[model samples]
Target: MLLLTCPWCGPRDETEYHYGGQAHVAYPANPAELSDEEWAEYLFFRDNPKGPFAERWVHSTGCRRWFNVVRDTVTYEVLAVYGPHDPRPELAAGDPR
Candidate 1:
């Protein structure tokens, strides 16, 4: 099982957490001006990266708090775990978060 470090609760079994999908997505600043395709993209599209990625997770069995994690897509190597209030970590190349 993958081990995840919860900044507040310390390291715990991955089973204690819940993956919350891709993180740090921002809504369009001017949604009114976006074309139909652009609006659809924002609503339905998310990057499927092959390498490192940032994702949101919830410690459902622990703190029950949400946090961000940077991990490798292929290897599942967790590089960092930080709270929502913290600044984004230095991500692997091409990681938008």
Candidate 2:
């Protein structure tokens, strides 16, 4: 089983958490001014990268707090774990998104 380290509760099984999809997605500044396509894009579109990606996760069974994780999609290896408000860290020279 995969293990995720929660910012508040430390390491826990992946089952103890909830995946919140891609992180760092910004809300539209003017929702009312958006066209149908724009609204749909904002709601459903997300990056599906093959390598390291930033994602949001919530520790449901533990502290029940949200946090961010930079993980490798192909290997399922977590590169970094950080708070929700923290900026994404710089990956190593060989790491790619």
Q: Please, what are the lDDT tens digits per residue for candidate 2 over residues 28-74?
A: 99999999999999999999999899999999988889999999999
List the RMSD of every prediction in angstroms.
Answer: 3.7, 1.3
lDDT of 1 by residue, 5-54 (tens): 98889999999999988888787999899999998988888878887778
Question: What C-alpha lDDT does candidate 1 achieve relative to the native structure?
Answer: 0.86
Q: Kindly report which residue stretches of model 1 are placed more than 4 angstroms away from their true locations once superposed.
A: 91-97
Q: What is the lDDT of residue 1 in candidate 2?
A: 80
Q: Considering every candidate listed, which one attains the maximal lDDT?
A: 2
Top-TM-score candidate index: 2
What lDDT does the true structure give each of the candidates? 0.86, 0.92
